[model samples]
Target: MDVAINYLEENFAERKIKIQAQEYLHRFYGSLGFKQVSEPYLDDGILHIDMLREK
Candidate 1:
């Protein structure tokens, strides 16, 4: 993930990364510096929350 982000940073100047994380992995991603952007919602019946990380 870091490699891809580094490449994007060099190639495109991205400012943030966004994801829809499963309920169980919120803390894991949060620990990586992601922050919640939206309330939880179901995707194909599995709950998810939108998260974002500034690059």
Candidate 2:
């Protein structure tokens, strides 16, 4: 996941990355610099939130 984001940011010149992170893993991703962009919501029976990281 880290390598993928890196490629998008470096090779693809992506300024923003968006993800629908599962609630439980939100903290893990947050530690990697993702920030919540939306309140938690249900998706496919799991809680999720919109997250984004800006490069």
Candidate 3:
């Protein structure tokens, strides 16, 4: 996952977009520079968090 993200980051330099993932998936995206945005919240009965990587 990290390798793929690195490739995307390197390849998508002009997108100026943000990538987000839930808390459970935090570690995967974190390795690629994404940061936790806030505490977990209940969404559809599951705990969710927002992590984002800015372009």
Query: Please, what is the whole-model Cα lDDT of each candidate in the order they appear?
Result: 0.87, 0.92, 0.67
> lDDT by residue for model 1 over 15-42, one digit each (tens)?
8988889978999889888899999999
lDDT of 3 by residue, 1-55 (tens): 6566567768866333354456688787777677788788878877777776665
Lowest summed-lDDT stretch of 10 residues in model 3? 13-22
Taking every candidate in turn, the Cα RMSD to the unseen true structure, in Å, is 1.4, 0.8, 3.1
lDDT of 3: 0.67
lDDT of 2 by residue, 1-55 (tens): 8998998988989999999999899989898889999999999999999999987
What order do you get sorting by TM-score, best first?
2, 1, 3
Better of 1 and 3 by TM-score: 1
Query: Model 1: how far is 14 from its true place, Å?
Result: 1.0
TM-score for predicted model 2 compared with the true structure: 0.91
The pairs that clash in candidate 2 are: none
What's model 1's lDDT at 14?
Answer: 81
